[model samples]
Target chain A: MIKVEWFYWLCGAIFIAVAALTFADGTNAKRYGSGAFWGLLGGAFIYSTFVVHKTAPASVLGLAVIMMALLVATGQLGRGDTTGPSRAEQEAGADRFGNRLFVPALTIPVVVIIFAVGLAKIHVGSEPLLEKSSETLIGLGVASIVAVIIGFVMLRPKSPLAPLSEGRRLLEAIGWAAVLPQMLATLGQLFVAAGVGKQVGRLTEHVLPSGSLFGGVLVYCVGMALFTIIMGNAFGAFPIMTAAIGYPVLVQHFHGNAAAVFAIGMLAGFCGTLCTPMAANFNIVPAALLEMKDKYGPIKAQIPTAIPLLACNVALMYFLAF
Target chain B: MLVLLGVLLVVIGFALRLNPLVVVTVAGIVTGFLGHLSVIAILNAFGNGFATSRSVTLFVLVLPVIGLIERFGLQEQGRRLIARLHALTTGRLLVLYLLIRQISSALGLASINGPAALVRPLIYPMAEGAAERRFGRAIPEAMREKVKGYSASADTVGQFFGEDIFVAIGSILLITGFVDTTYHLKLDALNVALWAIPTAICAYAIHGTRLFLLDRRLDRMAEAAGLTTRPDKADAQEAGR
Candidate 1:
């Protein structure tokens, strides 16, 4: 049997090796630096999980691997610098928005989230919601993939995003990364559904103070937000956190509105999207798409906005809810 | 057992990197199997989810329409319209949009697409065009990019602050239920929604002022960029004629 620690070490080694390979390629370096950055980031994350010991290291490593591969495969990092029209220059003509690679890239996380949520909902006999959600996500993924392929075919620029000769190669890279989160999230759901959450709940009840609804809500929201920042997607964090606090304390004992609380709480969690590097889709994609001088330009712009909003959400719960 | 199997299939399928559609379809099949329903039952669930969330689909459809409008002269016309009005600055334009976006969202019409779906395609382009008309070229790419960022930022702020004010929104309902159950406070969704209005108004006002200041800042940047060649009043009058 493979020990978890051994798996971590192996994954860590793989991530570092991949990072080295990416650095070697000049063309790959520019288009997909974010992916390499994430591979290293993932390694750090997996190592940290061992330190924290409160979370699953395998899932964290899994997601990081997927993100790393996707970024590389999609030519997000090492595409040759061809600084086209600036926003001002583009404003001169009609076709200023440029190639919308971010749109398809976005589908990766969205599909992962929907798949995770559907899996969670299914455990509760909300079979219909689960089935529908899965189908919708699948439909969206198919549409996006097909659109991107067709765009590549029709738009066909000379120094294309990927090597046309290696068309299958690009697809394999993206396809590998794309499937990971869905699997991990499902595993997470199963772990939670199969009574891991119940154990977590028991531990929390003994440790936390009684009659501390405020504390509960605070912990839950902050935990969700922080976890999302770490994980990059709130949906990934949702099942685990909700399984622990949301189901046991918030919904079951406290009688909070399950749907509203989860939805808004998740939104509150998404506020972390503005601050963290881990939420590469929100942080890194905009940078890659815009080619900003400062790598953290998107995050810098978002802080002024996200911090106050998080405070408001907390206050909203206290003032409005309580 | 069936539900368990369905869940397992979903987990394994995604792990294998199969097409997301294929993974999901398999998941749906597994779910239906567990529920002791046939293939038709699974298909119906898919239809039902779409039908229930039709509003979201409508929001998606609005994107192409906005794209088409921008394809015409809508954005340029908007910029020309604003440029002629001299009183309108970048900040003022964004602040106005923030208010509109917030108010609409608060009214439970959060379906109105912003930034990526609307502002990027329409509002930012027009604002840039207007800035160019007044300043006469030389706008930096960084500053222009900042404009796009700000446009998206405004939409996000407005949506985040305003949506809670609508009592009917899922967030408000959630808050009420939590309060009622935990502390036994007997709070109403309407109460939570109503209370959110003041906060929403405050958000609008605060964001609006920031937008105004942003306009001043952009104006300075424009001046620094040596884009201060305002169209002559006589020329404007001639153009008007």
Candidate 2:
């Protein structure tokens, strides 16, 4: 039975390789800090599940992971050299291969879709190819491996390790920002448990006049957009906003269509994504990469679009979600 | 009031520009403790939360593949391919890419044109090249910058509206999880994705027009402040090879 645990073990092994390479990277200034950061995360993954039961004590595991997060958060965890092939090499290869370079790139989603559906029904001697319940996640893991194989066959780099080294280099460049989603999700769960959602519900209820469904939907949509801008991620904002304004007001008070309400609510959040420096990857990074004089250039071009789109989401939810 | 501290911590932390990982960790720990959970219990919540959300970072798997692809010169090939196409202007090129990015993302192929993977290398260069050719010389820095900005926003606009249309994506799953857990409403993912279509269309119309207008701005810049000349090309031209 190919289950989720095996997938984690696979992930744990990859984290180990990341750690080993971090250790081996001689060019990094604070190599030990970088190595320990990845190494400790690798340990957490491997030992937390131990392929089945979590072998590590919760306190020990917690403290160690917390310490590592602290190290990463405090900016102590360093980065390795991220320089890759020079422009000359890149263009030379581009000249040789042309558009065929996309073959390896496109392999990923192709393999993922096939595995996601195919594995569920394929039988092996009166048994399915995968344990049936969580086929999607497992399929994703298998697809990644398949994509790697396709990459090797297509690219045929000078050495097999080229992929791993390049991968590690990119991973290290992303660094502390990489785990922001996981950390934010944890915070979201804590906020829910701490009754923050209830507080937000109360606050929104007081602010909006009672029993106005349109008012409730409008508040909810606008709040979601504004809050996503503040938080920098719509995913992080979704749980809290949904629990607070969305569930209590939009869904229950108005008895709105849950699907339309939440879907449009998240879209509203993306409008915020369009107009914020907080979404650095989308807005700021491109400005920087393009060598724009104004760092907020993307946000400027996007605000007009984001505002109208946000208004459309509000109006759409008010109409469709009912 | 104590429960609200977690919200306060996040706002203040982010506004203060603190490290996000630290801010969130502190918020989680503080909220857990105030909710009367013991330290071990808080840690346990942290552990389980991290464990369960492993799927969130599955993009890590494809990152290496993308890195390898880039290292093998995908971006340059894209640039070269763009240079060969004579009909593309800045506005038209960006709009075309926006469509491609959005449609592919809707199909759950978002990684194909991601910021690091596509925009920085392929999209920026191609857009720059088109703008350079349109202006009859190196475009002014300001115009080039706006072109880059629009290029970047194209990817963002594409994925934002596009991803939700694929019901299996994380945000859709998040909705399924939310509605099920919160309202006891068993909403189908496809329903949410279907409703998302109109909103996606609206986003496309709004952002696509902005991209299209960028061409006029490029023309204005070229006319007013003569194009900046660049020193290169003794290196090698496309057909010269």
How high is each candidate's TM-score? Answer: 0.45, 0.82
Look at candidate 2 and give me any clashing residue pairs: none
lDDT of 2 by residue, A112-171 (tens): 556666666788888777765446666667766787788788778898887777778777
Worst 10 residues of 2 chain A by lDDT: A50-59
TM-score of 2: 0.82
Please provide, for model 1 over A74-182, each residue's C-alpha lDDT reduced to its tens digit, 9 standing for 90 to 100: 5554433323224453244324333332233233334434444443244444334333322323333333344345444533434443322222222223333333333
For residues B29-143, what per-residue lDDT tens digits would candidate 1 score against the true structure?
A: 4555555655444443332221122112111211222222233223443344334433345676778777867776665445334444456556666566656656656788767
Which residue runs of candidate 2 sit more than 4 Å off their true CA positions?
A50-60, A121-133, A209-216, A247-264, A288-295, A315-322, B104-152, B162-198, B213-241
DockQ of each: 0.05, 0.41
Give chain B TM-scores in order: 0.59, 0.70
Candidate 1 docking category?
Answer: incorrect
- Taken over the whole model, the C-alpha lDDT of each candidate is 0.49, 0.74
